[model samples]
Target chain A: MLARTSLRELRHRPLRTALALTGVAVATAMLVDMLMLGGGIQRSFEELLRSRGYELRLSPRGTLPFDTEATISGYAELRDALASVPEVAGVAPVLAYSISVETTDSPDEPQTSLRALALGIDPREQGLLRLLEGELPGSGEVLLDRRTIEETPLSVGDTVDLRVAGGLDVAARSGRARVSGIAEFVFSAREDRPIALPLEDLQSFSEMGDVVSFAMVRLTDGSEPDRVRADITARIDRVEVTTLTGIVTEANERLSYFRQLALILGSVSLVVTALLVGTIMAVSISERLGTIAALRAIGIPRMRILRALTAESLALCALAGLAGLGLGVVVAGVLEDILSDFPGLPQAVDFFVMRPSTLLLAYLLLLLVGAGAGLVPAWRATGLEVASLLHAEEP
Target chain B: MSPAGPARDTRGVIVVATDVTRDYRMSGSIVRALRGVSLSIPEGDFLAITGPSGSGKSTLLHLLGGVDVPTAGNVRFLDRDLGSMSVEARASLRLREVGLVFQRFHLLPMLTALENVELPLAAVGLGPGERRARAEERLVRVDLGDRLDHRPGELSGGQRQRVAIARALANDPAIVLADEPTGELDRSTSRSVLDLFRRLNDDGTTIVVATHDLELAEGARRRLEVVDGRVEA
Candidate 1:
């Protein structure tokens, strides 16, 4: 009966119902997109960070200055010294840098900034190279980063142009280096653009030899990460020693700001949706005054009045939510290209990929909004005077 | 369930309105719609209330049906004081006992003739098959069995009223209160609906018809006329 009544009411004023439904759809779509984007970006960031094969990240003494490379060469002897530490199994030295990948010969084409992390390691130990093609670089050969492998306009055995710099000492040099292979790190912490080169080659180009960036330490015993971390800090000096877990925590903090912005906008959109639903219900109840009065006069209980109206509101919102979900998917698809340029966010949101917890939260929010919208109108219908309504001349 | 079923206590008067007054606040000014109107209706009797538009006849019907609360006085049904009952109790009593038919038919536009008739039975938790069978029987009683699937819009005013009447008796209520049941019909249609009411009354359903039509008032077993919210002899 409630469904039937809602259908009748919706059919009675097609234009008004369509307009109200559209309003709800737009608001709901914006909120869904925001929420999905937040979730996807956070997941992408976590995935990127986890791929580095460390439980925690250790930074030097205080905070590492922004944009300044944290070199392992500064403490290279110290990293080699950690082999005696019983908790530590293997350590890989990593170099992080930013370089531009030229996709077009027309220098006018936008230069894409690539985040390159060059690792100086003996590939024979805990082999990190899940090579898509050629073998890992021997001494001088360089591997291209996964994201820019195809788009970097560099193929195997290509003579790549390079300009490496750090603070004051920098060199511009091009070399006929072999593109050994293309490999992907778990966390695409960088933007869509990524490039990787041999650590020795990068050191020579930047005029800093025998220096590595950071050491990624893998623990032999997973259960003792905290104890291992405290022992490492006690043993080390000047240079900061970090476990992989610390980097993940910092990365999560960095990701929360973007996610929070999306959430706030989503919340604002939901508020607008609630107002739209309330206004539509208020107008509907006022227009259907005679019908409500008729129902009351015919012995329909006040509770039924509340139930019917609430059912109508909820049905409308559910339909709108469905439409909004579709719109959100479309929005995510369309914006993926534009958002690829954003350094910290994922290129595309996970459309239709709602987590159970998030969906449950959204469901509860929509239900409350629907019930609140229907309450005042239902109350008004129940409180109406049936006698006056029946006897009064019809307008 | 039959009205003769063992549940009903049929020894006392069915309806008793004692000093019932309905007050309304219009534009912040209190206006008394019914001023100290009192009446007693016996079981199995057909009663008609007649009055001018503003003379409180509709108010009397609403009060009798337990659709609205009286401002100062009380209404008793089978010796149970309706005024003392909570809102939920009054609603239950109306659902399980009293039936109401309004002028303009008050048939839900979305419901077909049979579905409209089955509406009150929904309150009593009747199954769909039982409700349909009972609704069909009542519609046949009102001479509308063939038009069961027709919505109120497709039916004529008189047919709609007949459907409303069928709905009123769906729960086999002891008292059926009707407000201007024939006001929207032609003379012939009005007579037909009134005839159906007469037959239903003969079948032992106590009915209260509120109307301004003299002919309708005359057909009832007892008649009361109101003027300026007071009963007129």
Candidate 2:
């Protein structure tokens, strides 16, 4: 029924209806993008933290991962103590530092010495990077990042010299390692050139005995993260035990600027939608005032007329809002691409994530704008004086 | 072809307006459109309220049709006070009982002639098939059976008014209040529409036409002349 009368009225003015649809589509698209971005970063961070099933992180006191150069001194005893906790499944101690190395086994090309960020981990218990081609680094082997291989002419099965960087005596903590594989570093930013090796190798290379930057603790299934975290905090010292939830909360606080931006722009989009729909409907109803007044004279109820007008606006918004969702996905993809280039963010992290809730919220807001935009004009149109209008006299 | 006669209801009086005065506020002063006018329309009566433009003839008809409220008096339809009815109830009353026609014919320009006639039937909760059937019947009665698919822009002035008249009779109302049934038609077209109204009145459908044309007013069985918002002697 609404299709026949309400939609017909909208179809009567094709140019005006098309323009209204375009305006609403653009506004809703912006709104959807904002809705996605408002939570995308935080959600992606939480997913990254829980990706490897490690529910807790042990970082140096008052520092996030890779945030500072501070390390946990005497980490071997702490790692053993953490492994003894009842809820602990396994623990992987990781150390991060810089190393300067040149190819030792590749005799075809001239040796090019380059500095790279290095991670030393218990290879069997690590949850950080995925192997792309070859095996994890063993006793005398190293996993090179793709970027490091791109800079140096070394591939898997080649050997390179490794020396701990930024110390007074460079030769004291130096060793040679065979390239075992290429790896996908989960937290590698665009600027990072990284290499991974065993914990003892790096500890020996850096000459920092029994030291590491952090430890990732995997909890047994169904174990309460807070209980384990509390137990670890009580039993461990000189380290902070952070749960996945806490890391995500802290990330949200840090991403407050983006969230505020989303709120402002999302609100602007809604206002634009309402004003565009309202102005178009008001003008359309003004043009059709005579027809509306005649409809009233012929006994069409005000509620029915109002409903028809609202249906017209809703139809416009529904069609355009659907289009907006598709357009927003494309727009969000492009924006995520551009925003991910921000320095220090991991390559695997997304800035604009679309979920079911975002789509539903955007759709619901469109309907609200539709209803609000049509109400005032419809009320006025139905409230016209029938007798004066029919007589072609001003009321 | 013969037209349907007036509904066979035996009620005596259909509408009554007592000492009705309608005023308008224009440029800060009151313009009294109708001043202390009183009248009663009986069932099946062919009445015309004739006066020149701005003489309040249309205003009187509007009050009688329940489209406008009187500023100073009461309007009663079927022994029920119209002024006290809810706005929706009054609109329902007009939809189900009083058929209003305008000088311009006021046919929805966007609708085909049949769709225009179906508007009131749809308002009355008729199904699509039922609304179409009844709308076709009303248009055929007004000698517009062949013009059902034509829009008002495609029809002649007389045809449009015929469509308006058909719409007015769509629900088989007790009385139709036409403000100016043929004001926009040529003399011959006006007579054609007038003849259709006379045919309905002859078959006993009550009608009230407000017009400035004396010839059109003379065709009515009962004439009430309004001048300067009062009934003339």
Candidate 3:
């Protein structure tokens, strides 16, 4: 009887049913994409941080504020002294610089700001280099950010002209370095891009000599990073020392606002979906008032009528949820390709990974929406006056 | 024709109505649809309630069928008071013991002829195969064996009404309460439906029909005409 009633209600007004389905699908798809985007960002951040083998990122006191810029220097004598700390495993001196490159595809494109950090270290730490191709660049070679590929036309074995910040003369360095690789860095609390190279070569070419911008440290096993950072900060008065935990915390604090905004938008979409479903179900119940009365008159119990209607609502929601899930995956995939051109986004993040727990939660929410929409109508149908409704006279 | 056994008189009265009255709450006023109607129907009896429009015959049928409760008096079916039963229990009883046919032949629109007959059985705890077989048998009995898969919208008025009858008889109930079963049919179709009711009565399936058509009412074994909610001599 429920199957019969549901089918009849759905068929009676095909257009309305289709509209309800589409509304639910749209809402569910949006919800899924929102959740996927959040998860992808978190994953990309975590993976990027873990790849560098730096358990903690320490920065100067009040030096790197959110949406602001700051830098610290590593005096050669201080670097040697930091390596003498008991928990210090190794200190890789880093020279950081910012520059912009104009791609052949769009020459007038605003010089997109990039964080080019030169690492003065042995070329043996392959774990530190998250490469998408060939190999890590030698001293003379430079590796671009992984996100730069989609935005620029520079390919393997191509010479890139780089214009340093505050330098009027564009450095047209002609050298064919193997595409060597592309890599990701920890997402910043502000707009920051990552580019890597052999540390000493960058200093000599850019005329910024002997000044190490920062030092990335790998701690020994079982060494508490905060204790190490505190010890280092107390001893070093000339430059600031920031821990990796501090860096991650600051980054998350900034991303949390965007995540909350996404959540609010997703919730609003779901509420609209609920209203649409409720309206459609109400009309369906009203239109089928006569049929409900007929069933009741035939000695069919009121509860069965309620069950039948509830089942119908659930089936509708399930069907729409499944369709929406599929659509959401496709939409996210397409968006991923489009977002590739924008380096501000986390690179190569798969935004359509549907987790079972997420799908389960979504299904439950949709079921609740379906049941809630059907409640009033089910109650009204059960309470109908059988004699009045079933009488032969058309009133 | 009685079954060849000692008439199971110990089963008690199958349906008993004592001073049952039904009233409608109209626009700011209560209109009495039935007034102090009392009747009892034993098993295997065929009774007809006849009245004009607004005469309350349908009200009486509803009370007797347990589709409704009287506003004043009580209706007891098989020794259980209809008014006392919980809503769920009443529905269970309807599924188990009572079959209803209406003037409009209220077949579920989406169901085929056979499936429409099978609908009432769905709420029962019967297996799917048994439900299907029973529905098929009932449809075949109603002379719709060939139209098993034809939906109600595809069937004629007579065919649709036959499907309703098949649905009513699907549960093999104790009583079949039909409210103007032929009210929407042509003269020939009405006679054919009345003939079907007569045959069902002959088989000792208790039948109570509410109607205004004289020809339909006159053919019943027992007749009670209702006027202003009271039985007329």
TM-score of model 2 relative to the true fold?
Answer: 0.94
Best by DockQ: 2
Q: TM-score, each model?
A: 0.88, 0.94, 0.83
| lDDT assessment of candidate 1 | 0.71
Q: Write model 3 residue lDDT over A51-84, tens digit each, in one string.
A: 6787544344556422223445445676677777
> In model 3, what is the error at residue A248, expressed in angstroms?
3.4
Local lDDT at A252 for model 2: 93
Question: Best candidate per lDDT, number?
Answer: 2
lDDT of 2: 0.86
Query: Which of the two candidates, 1 or 2, achieves a greater TM-score against the reference?
Result: 2
lDDT of 3 by residue, B1-233 (tens): 11111123357467999998888888989999988999999888889998888898888888887878889999988778899987667776777778888888888888888878877887675678988999999988878899999999999998899999999998888789988888889999999898988988898889999887899889898999899889995
The collision pairs in model 2 are none
Instruction: List where candidate 1 sits over 4 angstroms from the true fold.
Output: A64-67, A74-76, A97-130, A146-154, A157-176, A185-198, A204-206, A344-360, A385-395, B1-6
Which of the two candidates, 1 or 3, achieves a greater DockQ against the reference?
A: 3
Give the CAPRI rating of model 3. medium
- B120, model 1: CA deviation in Å? 0.7
Query: Candidate 2 vs candidate 3: which has greater DockQ?
Result: 2
Q: lDDT at B141 for candidate 3?
A: 83
DockQ of all candidate complexes: 0.52, 0.59, 0.56
